[model samples]
Target: MEKWDVVVVGAGPGGSYAAKTAAELGLKTVFFERGRRPGDKNSSGCGLGQRWWRDFPEIMEALQGLPSVRKVEMVVINLVDENNRLRYRCGTTGSDLCANRWPHGMDGISIYRRDLDPFLADLAVKAGAELRTSTLVSDVIMENGQVKGVRTEKGEPVYAQVVIAADGAMSTMARKSGIRNRWGGGCTLVPQLDFSADPDKMDDVIGNAEWVWFGALYGAYQVNFRDGFHIGAGQWLREDWDEKPTDMVKKVLQFPAFQAMCRAIDAKPREYQAHLLPWLKKPPKTYTGGMMLVGDAAGFPCPLEAEGIWHALTSGKIAAETAAWAISRGDTSERALSEYERRWKASPLGKEHEFGPEFVDLWNSTIFDPKLMARQIQLLLEFSMLHPFSVVFDWGDAHMDCFNQHLEHLLDLAPQFADFGRTYLAPLARGIWPKNVKRILLSVKPRIPVLGKLPDNTFLRLVAKLSKSLAPYLDPAVNQEAPLPREVFERSRKG
Candidate 1:
């Protein structure tokens, strides 16, 4: 039995970050993983914002030396008709309309997790943390209703003053700690399949960018990478998921878009692996009590977007600071660790965490419906085509209120907007547009700038006005609890 100041289980982003930060702060940290090597068990590609690396300057510096696929601009999103006969595409970003734009890069960066994950693990070692591979954490050690350490597969006890569970999704530790049960049906399980292709052909197919597909490819979404492409889909499971991932990929390729994506890459799906992705609705109140839960263990995955890598890394950093605070005080009490939650609330990612559930409901429902998905793409096209500048830059960066306002604006166009989403939008578009135009337009620029760009103050006011109009249709009770931003009541108001 070797006692340590902090023991971090799972060497993925969260675990490695916790170990690195704590060790750098002079704590004796031990990081463990079950994988044979850092990248062995990791996936191939992921879509994430570059802002995630803002806190870890060293990580960003290293990214400069790695191969990257820059998505400086994006074209319109595509939505398919049921028969796959008609396709619609539209330009959603300003890079397509304007030649020059500041920060001339993708809104986010896409990387092969194999390369990126291992790189991050190495950073922990450089920061003074000892990382052990092939070590599995099977259970946690608890005494007097408090956690003390963890039990390993080798039957060894790795004791620590404090333990941080950065285990990825499907965390056995989280369940043992009673933080959460098996995730609910609302959680989306995504299986990713990676395929290799010729560099030139891959370049031509991917073309310096990436795109997300919804309600197509058998209603499964897809993303492409530089050396290859990723194909798979996710759905809310009402029961425990026991199906092999390879089978799921076969089922997903049945979708027309998935087929097209596979053909474009000039490859066949020979293999697949499954990773559990959890959608966390809120931060757990009691993630620490001599033990802390971060990353997917705490259900930090964004419920709405199905993206958790950034959240995992961010929480891991905060958990590290809080762990240090505990060690310096020579106490690992729940009260002391509360700073973890407090600091989290102050961070940008924390602010977004609060609305996870709301976002999840909206996205899952809207995205699952093919007709609604297509109309949404069409709506974006209509707006972006008309007001390229306003639609492009400002609309995206505006405050939450402005986005909510636009939602209301779209709702007003059709009285029963939410209710008649797919059932109406599909028929309406098919009936309204000439078949030829629809076919040609699907590949053209999509997205709209109807929300009108203005200075911050004026834009906020516009959002408030639209929110008021939505009051009649929305549930007053829920609105009151997490009040939608009104003109007079801004979520972030400065004096």
Candidate 2:
């Protein structure tokens, strides 16, 4: 039996990053991958958020050198009628908010996991983390009610002072370790197709943009890459909706917009993949005695968008830091490891996860529901197609009247939607009432002449104040300024 300081299961972003950080900190870390290679089992209609680079500048530098990555400049939300004609389209191009936020000046990088995962795993290797492939961690090694390490499928025992489970949504380590019993009902089944197309044609058609289709039961997204594109459909599954995920994929492919995009690029299907995405209302238990969980295994996927890569990388680094801290103190008990949970809760990942449910509720009521979304799209189309001369000479009273009528209709349904939102959102989150009220006021402010002209700083200040008042309710664990354990800080400095 070979003993190590840390053992990481699964070599996805979470596990690889964990291994990398721990190894770089002078810990003897081992990373395991069940597939023949790191990304063989992974699938994503991948858009790596710009925040990843903003937080990890080293990663940004590395990604810049990769041929598989594409800088995405535009993200479009589209509503297409049944006939496949574009009904409404809204998007931001260059100089978007993301470009303004990050020095890198791009929204995100679109990628293929086959290239990304392997590249990330290699980073761990270069950082001195031992890599093992074709190894399945079948169970955690436990004794006297604490995890000691893991057992491989071939019955080889690997011992470690700490184990990090990054095995994904259906994490065997999490279940077997009794940290979690089962997955929740709020899971998404995403079925996707990978296609190879002429790069010139793809560039012309996609033009550094990503497209998301609304007004469909299974919402679809199209992401362009260097040599290809990934088109996928996602459906949030509840008990009442029993359709198979593959069937949903087939149905989404029938959409006219998807068909047109494929035809335009002359795409040839290269692969079909499906994966389970966890959308927990709150993060699951991430730590126990001598063990910790990160990434999808810990249910850290973004609740609103189901984006896991950002959370995966962020949590992986945090877990490694926590593990190193506990090790330096020579304590691997559940209590010591609990700091992992505390740190993550105080990090940016925590803030995003905490607010996920509220965003989901807003999205579901305003955009996810096809009927409501269709009506809204129709209104936008009508407004855009109106003649400019009629607006200037005819005084636009008729246009105003039509708009007011539509507004009245929406207002009439507000109470019903509010009731539904309360019921639906209550279980997933708290402190939504104040946020909802603020959102409503902001939406209406644009229609008020004077208020609409007010500087952006006014609304920003109002939000800042609201956040201060609501902090306790939104996150009970708000200790962002707490000092790190003395020993951990010393060791980090030495490393």
Alpha-carbon RMSD of each model: 11.0, 8.2
Writing each residue's lDDT as its tens digit, candidate 1 over 27-131 gives: 999999999877677666776654544555556556646674434245335554445532444445555424332233335556777777788889899999999
Model 1 alpha-carbon miss at residue 454, Å: 21
**Which is the leading candidate under lDDT?**
2
Candidate 2 — which residues are off by over 4 angstroms? 82-84, 93-98, 362-495
Q: What is the alpha-carbon lDDT for the whole of candidate 2?
A: 0.77
Tens digits of lDDT, candidate 2, 30-94: 99999999989998447887786678778867776677677787788777664557666777666
* Model 2: pairs clashing at backbone N, Cα or C within 3 Å: none
How far is 115's C-alpha from truth in model 1 (Å)? 0.7
Clashes of 2: 0
- Indicate which candidate wins on TM-score: 2
* Predicted structure 1, TM vs. truth: 0.74
